[model samples]
Target: MIKLRPQPLRGRPTVSVVVPCYNYGRFLPDCVSGVLGQEEVEVDVVIVDDASPDGSSVVARRLAAADQRVRLIAHETNRGHIATYNEGLAVAEGEFVVLLSADDLLSPGSLARSVALLQAHPEVGMVYGFSPTFADRPPTPRTTARSWSIWPGLEWIEQMCRRMSNPVSTPEVVMRGSLMREFVGYDKRLPHAADLLLWLRAATRGPIGRINGADQAFYRKHGANMHVEMFAGVYTDIAERRRTFDILFDEDSACFPDGHQLREVALRSLAREALVTMCQAEKLGQVGDEPHDKLVALAAEMCPPERDPRLWRAYERTQTRSRSGRGPVVPRTVGRAMADLGGRIRWRRWRRTGLMSAVGSL
Candidate 1:
């Protein structure tokens, strides 16, 4: 469907939130209510039911009926999440767009806070904030956004490449409608890391904004979450993230001059990740399930021997044996200590900022 952008509202900005559901009927009410109850924004929710087996369509229809701000688009056949996302985004007529998963939720003032940043900084095309993850019930957010952080598009891309991770989760992102529509949709190829790639693409258009000192959304953690289901193991996650970068470089390398160097940075980061995972597996004697040899090979392939000798030597030491040729008992101790230090650093970062510095096998 061709979207006709609606005229700007008189006072509040109109935000079109696309809540995509697939067998998450139980969580639909909470998800949609959060979008509708957002303060200081005229919010319209487009609930796209992707032909779920659970009675999600019924719930969506009921939501649409209950409020004029809510609309339902039920697919007869399961076209998958990528298609569903594009279909819903294609119909967004509001000033801003949010692709919120049905299982997640927005914090009380998330949309309004994001809108404020976007409205103030015309250079920023995308705005995201901290999202705290929860299991059963979400914790109430106490603070409001105290300040905003804005980064140039290229700088943001560089940061992403250096870290080789996604900072913004799905629900935490609020995209400028025009910039969001610049891309066709979430790439069908990247079922695991489409959101990461999409955010990078958005950053190419303009600067990125972040809301600080407060939470933006609630990221629900469960058995059936997409990341948990798709990336069940370490190897799968590392490979998919590598694929995401490949597509990113292929599509938007021209946008940034240092794209080649950034690609190498991302590759090395991922390679180091594999090596780290290999060490952890060995120390825990979990090598059987984790595939130590494959991890070593992946690390070698990504970083290469000449790229970084220290990292390569770490990999080699993990494979070395004692004088009796038994196992890497001595090296395992060192690896375990290194792993513990890395975990502590990551924990500190996560505690300081609600965002995870690294995600999915990192």
Candidate 2:
């Protein structure tokens, strides 16, 4: 167990915003400025250049020279993102820490808002705000009813498990430095979903807080995004999710004593994702057979034996639509008919089981 750092005395606590850059030299200044521009807060900015060929080190050094609070750590050799994060954490000295990517920008007052929430609620380990994902153009501002909301740790974890998707973007997140120090930096074995895992881990420790508007952060959707690579079949999202579940189970067995429920939730989530991916593939008719086969195989492994028939039926319908060039879109009447058919099938299944498995088997 790692020792927890003492909380700072009453006043504005320092925030260490670490910007890890690989080949994002052009966006480094914008990212650094976003951190420095935070309203009413003391921020220590650490810009880590991971031996980028694009002279990111030069930009980092310039930023450091311009501000006393800003510092640069340029790697002689290119270390992976995980290594750079750990290096930054090792050097960071702040009550709250944020690992902002060099390519992303934090919205105005984001740091102050996040810090205020953490200060108000000492029980929360991590706080994140809404981030609008955009490509090429900047996102327009949006309003919200409340500035922020608080969620109990376990409640937040349950919500994440149910959604099976990461709603918290990296730039919008602020973590308690002490809690972050408890664990080693991002897991190398699960690079694709390391941030998700970290958020879940933090949630296990305490409650989570969220600033409730898209104006908190701006997530740039470009070709270089790690998630885009994962979606393009460069890395296995399914396997990464599975590994994440296993890690969480091992770390917090007390929270999930059986592991059966968690496995089911994960499988169901994967099945849902697979269906969406299949729909996209069918609509485009461009995905290769190998990738599609892998998706099917993985889904089949997780799907319950009794629900296999339903899975096959859905697959056949999607394939038929794809080949017929009817596309993935369904007419209103056809959609209503399909929904009625599904209801009847679900009813029959429930009658046979003598219990309502509304949450159908994956």
Candidate 3:
């Protein structure tokens, strides 16, 4: 399955967007609309409905009715996240495929730009773009990177040994679907984090490319953000993620420092998992206890001198400070209460109206 260049293909390489939907009835339409609104390409949409309790299937079917390119695959019973994506990937016949989560929305021209980037750069195997977040409340802006590049070819098993600069947003990717089939599909072992591991595996095999263009997708940060609802699953995700990397660069491999670095990463992940679990359980005071001390010592033994964590990093929100190092003043009780109520009302209204299509520009 050669990935025919969109530039040289008889027509634009057919780009398929695999939208996996569960109970995201409210955001489904806008998510579908955002992709439908792209420019200059043959777009095929695959809407995989995971037996939504809500009427998400109705919305997806309606879109399929109106557009021939839109196809709906309704499951009889709900399969987990990774399986749903596997189902989508199984049926995809496009040169490039975009994995669009149901709760998210794509920016206009996202697929077009991603396909064009891969098309223009012959050596690039997979190409991705950036995403702006549209959480239920406004999302904080991410620190934009200076550039995006991953050795750009399968020949980078060497470069990946040196730099692991993978900053891909899956929703913003239009990757070579043909090449994607070469590897095992999403590991059911690590459902949600499977994509991140898949990308890492790609890095080990070759190079991934990024289109340094405008924001290409919108990640909705509502109360139902997939990761937010599954905090308990984080450690397991990290473990599986590390195992995936370890398989590629375990000791005895020619990839220098790669095997060593990855093993250290696995140990670090384990320590981080312990710290995070303790933090979530509000057992911060026990950081020097049995499990904690054990993880810390193992981390010291496994990691390079500079990489060891003597004390775990605690995640705590901090107040914004001025140039004088003074934090912003809090309003009086009455004002604070009133502002909270007002915010609740406004967000409820916004949620009711339903943010259709994460708008292209901001």
Candidate 4:
């Protein structure tokens, strides 16, 4: 049981969940249900509808009426998701906070597990666990947490810098309310990767925790998903990621002695990603001359020809193959085979641990 802090209205820790809705009225009920159904935690649901044209306000209002724990914030004008998220966060009055999308679902007992970690370890600012994605229906999630992994905040941030990707899928994250309030709101400058930035900022404040061998949330994948609609290509995604790293280091360089080195690490990783994408595009014949040119430009801009001669040479080889109009074929080089194996290993680790394991091992 979560030892209720200070104000224990019902002798339980209250978890305030913020659900942002936009044209997802059809999914609002299921999402709210998952949060309200979490065991052993008192939940307060705040639904912020961003002037969704799909009758989302009506759904939200109905939900609020049906359950006293649910509150509806209907925007008359269409504020973007960032503004909506901030407005909800500002009013959270609970021991813990969660920002869940209207299209996602929280796994059973997830809040309890998260609360337990926060109560036991006052130093852990945030905890997250596996969040599997589904299309039509949510899969049955793991209800029991078999183990926990905790990392020093700085170490986790460095691991994130090396990966150059967002590990936490929004709904799976549970943050201490006091720590979350200190940060205020998500950065408007990073609309595509605000969540990634938020996680990094949280790590700066205290230790990070991860629950293993269990699911924490379910992400719904569909045509209207923001990530799919906004980030249509690998190039845009990589650009935004690089921008995220730049902002992180620019703002908090004082916190890290190796900030410059970590930035370089991130840039090199991004460069390799761009080059790999170029190779994949050449093999599949999916990229046009213009897109291929953009990928090469990104690789050069990130890693430069002089900094990573091997990556540039590989880029040149890929360009030659693209010019020759080759179809998809098996990767023949040992380097390519090793890269594929490493990617698979990382994916499996993420599936089990909700994070990349063995930081600095690569």
> How close to the true structure is residue 206 of candidate 4, measured as C-alpha lDDT?
81
Record all residue pairs in model 1 with backbone atoms less than 3 Å apart, i.e. clashing: none
Worst 10 residues of 3 by lDDT: 353-362
Candidate number with greatest lDDT: 4
3 or 4: which has the higher lDDT? Answer: 4
Report lDDT (CA) for all predictions.
0.79, 0.72, 0.58, 0.81
> For every model shown, what is its TM-score relative to the native structure?
0.87, 0.81, 0.66, 0.88
lDDT, residue 285, candidate 4: 38
Candidate 4 residue pairs in clash (backbone atoms < 3 Å): none
Clashes of each: 0, 0, 2, 0
TM-score of 2: 0.81
User: Model 3: what TM-score?
Assistant: 0.66
Q: Estimate the Cα RMSD of every predicted model relative to the unseen true structure.
A: 5.7, 8.4, 10.6, 5.0
Position 42, candidate 4: lDDT: 90
Instruction: Please provide the root mean square deviation of candidate 3 (C-alpha atoms, Å).
Output: 10.6
Candidate 2 has its poorest 10 consecutive residues by lDDT at 353-362
Question: Candidates sorted by lDDT, descending order?
Answer: 4, 1, 2, 3
lDDT of 2: 0.72
Candidate 2: give the clashing pairs: none
